[model samples]
Target: MVEAKTHLATKPRWLTPVLFSTTIFLSASLLFFVQPLFTKIVLPHVGGAPAVWTTAMLFFQTVLIGGYLYAHLITRYLSVRAQIALHLTLWALALFFLPLAVSAGWSYDAEQSTAGQTLLLFAAGVGLPFAVLSANAPLIQTWYARTGGYSADDPYFLYGASNLGSLIALLGFPLVAEPLFGATQIGWGWTVGFWALGALLLASGLMARGRHVRTVAQTQTQSAPSLKTRLLWALIAFVPSSMMLAVTTKLTTDIGSVPLIWVIPLALFLLTFVMVFTNRPVASMATLRLGYLIGLGVLAVVFSNLLGIHVSVWSAVLTVVAFFLTALYAHALLYSERPSAEHLTTFYVTMSVGGAFGGFFNSIIAPSLFNELHEGAITVAVAAILLLIRAVRPSRTALFGALALVVVILAKTTLISTFGIFVFGAIAIVLFLAVATTIRHTEHALAWVIVGFLVAGQVFVNHGTPLLRDRSFFGTHKIVEQDGLRIYGNGTTTHGAQRIVDLTADRPEPQLYYHRNGPMAQVLTSAKADASGTVGIVGLGIGALACYGQPHQDWHFYEIDALVSDIAHDPSHFTFMSRCAPDAPTHLGDARMVLAEQDGLSFDILVIDAYSSDSVPVHLTTVEAFEIYLEHLNDDGVLVFHISNRYYDISRPLGRLAETLGLEARIQDYTGNTAADPGDVGSRVVVLSRHSEGLGDLNADPRWTPLASDGGRVWTDDFANVLEVLNR
Candidate 1:
């Protein structure tokens, strides 16, 4: 064991590093919890679009950079004791804004930009919390070096521990916490945890300056890193990070609107760090990377059509593994090449800068610059760049030869049949000219040309094609407008729009799960039976269900995102809203709050359809939510829930809740139907009725079967289990 330099408090040589690392780990874990939870809180207010997550990521990256800058200031100007005192003071001050919850009164405007709204809201809400938390690694590690009495190299190890905590918090939230405790309970729990953490910071501050550090003036070494090194780091960090975002985007867009699936990719990403940082290097890097790249290639092949295959659950799992491995490799490189303890804060600051750049490129730049995600192409380029940078003695001849080959292949791939012979001939001439020339620095100059061309080609490819991509604050939205109908997609799932096509036209009609025959359609049709029945639709996808409405029934559509509503309201896209419910109500806010204020304005039927592209909205599935839905529904009214899923069975949770509330429930499994005959397709509609007459009517339909409760447990706001209901 390494001996302690000047031991006080009888702490062992290993104890300081261990404690500091653990403290940093816990801090990072708690910090990450903020990203998902904060996002979830605002999701109900913002339309559940892929752009929302991206915008939130961009905000987080920005705040993290601020925190790193603050950390740099603390280490540069303040002594160890002063730094500790300052941090503790900040913690105390932050308490003035706690129970650490964002104000609920924040209004979302659809006409304003999505990115702009996200930034404004984030600035007002948890900006300080995020900025302070972001400083943890760089600040605490510096403190460990100065006051905790450890060798400079020891602080970097703590970074691995910090990421470990990050992984735990990211995974634990969806898999454990959110399902076990409702969002409100989790908020309270995190508040208490934050208070305890603040106390620990105080304790750490008291012990900070009791003993002197080996006083060595490590002055500023501000020489900029090499351009190659900067580019290498950016590429390495950016690829997998962006790829993870891409996968997440696809899942929500292709799959249904279920929020838990978001955790799947994030958890896998964290697991990658855990595997790579642990002693088992081979398991982390080599095998994982190979498996991931192969999986990514396969994913491109399987999901390219976007309309053909519906591998929501299985593809989601595969994507998680791919993203995890790629992210692991990239982050591991960052850890391995970490700067010395003396430059710890600078190192973290640079990483944050790189991270911010990555988010900017993927969330803001790519959608505008490229027709497709181009994630795989970018990943390969980055991996190659990182490999080249890692090589100590890179050869000019070898490098030039590789570049020539890559250029040749790319040209052939881009224009293979049209100009293959001419392109190959030009490539051969360039190689021959290179071999004949004895010019110095030729290889370096050629390398720059190759890189520039690669980037330009990527941009050109996108510009030349009309790729139907749109960028917002959170993510990219793909628009498919055809036959007078416009379909808005985030990744793979059709989010919202309106139907403008003539129903009698001889074309492929939009049908399947999105048809009006689903549960939402049932409510619209049934509610029409009662004159002046007001119906509320939570999610407004293509306004497809509006077609089922009768003139006597009043319908109000509550949509959080303006982008979705804009596309839905447009007559050229899907005209369901304009043609069917042109004069009906359109409430622009959270359904919960909007419906709450409309006392006695009960609906004949209430439909909860907020989806995360293809996943279930967990907030709507809880008992408290059910109670809210009931409140909005008239006595003897029916509550219809669209429970169609490709993966986990949700019938159990709905069944358990219906049984608990004394409301008769039945499940209709419509599994193998098509869109042409929308009414004939297979779906699982969880129908609920408080009135015996309503239940009798639903049961008489032969398609509805009474929910069986053998050993099923109720899903209250306090608890629910999705794993048990995954069609085992």
Candidate 2:
């Protein structure tokens, strides 16, 4: 399309490439870095809900699409000089919003809505800066292509460079910036970096000045993409972009809602782009084909827990890997189908549009429409189908689609009920087989039929599934029954459970963390609230603790997620609240924010059970949080912390905090016998109180052990090291 510029003997070929690449790299990296930083700043105020990050991703993707659209319009319509002037002016205007920080004194209230508040915070703090930064990759590549440089004809390698920077920034921030600096300090550094990026972009603009482009040559030789090609580009981009968010939700739903967890899937997502867009791809076509097959298999295991089968923690790791590989394939396909440099901005704009749709569907729309995370399964199934079409011939595509459908059906059938899960799974498998046969026999007349059959099968199986499912902004909540045990699932992990036939003498039996033999029962029996004493509980899960409330003890539950509160209070989901404490009013929003509004010593006992289904809301576990709990409790009140977690050992930190305040702390690590009811699962509780002598029988009990003090360590509001507590 252009004369490939051969540098003279004196002129270095690498100089222009370095300058252009630096601008692109810095822009992309800074854009990715700010996402976690801004989201982290907003997390505590919003009550550390997982939905906060998901929704933030939706906003970021939308802004990104806007930036790409701007780039496309300017590049298509404006002269080279005009484009540079407009971008520089916008960059300078964006600089007016420097040192991004969430506006102070904004926290969710009873009157406040979570989704709107998050949007407000983002807009007030970092929206302009993010939008401006998002334009850099597309615009800079266009500029570089016009520079008459060695890499001009094929400036797409610059896209890979930009993505590499993004991946590094994502992986580095949690490991470096977050640990080393406070939120305010991180913003200052980010501001400095942004200005530096602006300077580099200015330099790139100066270097890329041009009076002519080979338009006549391009028109004569290269054909512009048709409308069909553009739409195909958008669809390809949609799958992985949406799937990334879906898998991220999957990860955080299982692991805690921390920045580190949020960044992993995203970093891998960026890494795939880096690989595929490069001159040499990290995963070749053959590699992608094999990896996708493995990814499809891993997708099967993720569904196993939904079907009531035991899931290894390994499954989560495999799922992450699968998403990475499948994404590599998707982006690789995009790279293969890339258009000429003249259509560069248009190509990116189409891809960004697809990405925005994916983000909206998974982050915003899916939570409201479907009760459970059918999106993840749907994404995987559709990806397998589409990717199969790309990887092999029509005959092979249908065959693989049939096999994948069968695999999903088989996974669903592991629940294997009489007229329920098994029957639906069998029907689905047969339907897919028929579809596959039809494709072979009927010359692709009914390929779209596979989509309908697959979707219908999923809906019916989901409908027939035994678990009582509810969708909330926080995550999917499911009450699943097997044998005599009813368990509460947050994602795939069981957070709490109860027995159907009461094995305990009590009418309302406490199961899982609240079992009679469990530490909760021991403490409730010991720290009985007085006639006027108020009991404060954080984290409402199935309202299980209501069974232990002393009559007329003035119980007030502080719940962050409103949806969780509804499910707990509703009789259909669990009767603990309705049967035990029907009139116990709940305080909604973040537990910290709700408590901050209260007068100190408003309760006799404060129980912290916010760690549910692996979602350890870190803000709720910090030293500042402990102080708030103490202030809310009466002089001799008991502070109970449910510290059971799959990865984080929070006991050490909790013990340290108790020691700091000179409060007496005891930990009960309960393990029930084999003959005990399955619902009465074991638990660990850290009990802290100022006056243990006033703690009734708990003071003199031989079973209770004084906390083995931690290594003088604590997580504060300004500082937290979640990675240090890895169970490994």
Give residue 298's lDDT in candidate 2 (0 to 100). Answer: 49
C-alpha lDDT of all candidate models, in order: 0.61, 0.74
Question: Model 1 over residues 1-728: C-alpha lDDT tens digits?
Answer: 13344355476667666667667887888888877777776665555566667677788888888899899888788877788878877777766655555576776665677677777787777787677778887887777666545654445666667777887888788778866776678777777777777766655555555544533254334454666665666666666666666666666555533335555666666666666654446554444434433343333322332212244455456545545655776777766665556667777777778778767766677666765555434544444344434321124554445445434433443423234334334534564466346355443444333343334434433333322565444334566654445557744455544343453332223344545555444445443344436777886766767777776788888776555676667665556677777887777655665665567777776776665445545556767678888888878777777776655577777777787787888777766454454224565677788855665445576767787554566665345555566656
lDDT score at residue 150, model 1, on the 0-100 scale:
62
Clashes of each: 35, 0
The sequence of per-residue lDDT tens digits that candidate 2 reaches over residues 1-728 is 12333322234778888888888988998999999888887777785666778889988998999999998888778876787788888888888887775566766765566776777788887888898889888988888887767668878999999999999999888899777777678888888998898789778887776343333235334578899889888888988888788777777776767889899989999988987897877755765755655464445435423333333355566667778877887888889889888788889999999888898888777887988776776776666557435333335564456456545544544433354446445644664566556655432322344444445545654555655777777677777777777678766567666666542425567677787787887877663544326787888887888888887688888877777787777766667888888898898877888888766447778888887566666788777787887778778778888887777777777777777778888887777653756666667788888867646567677777888565755677766767767677
Summing lDDT over every window of 10 consecutive residues in candidate 2, give the lowest-scoring window. Answer: 1-10
C-alpha lDDT (0 to 100) for residue 297 of candidate 2: 42
Candidate 1's TM-score: 0.77
**Distance from true position, residue 480, model 1, in Å?**
5.6
Top-TM-score candidate index: 2
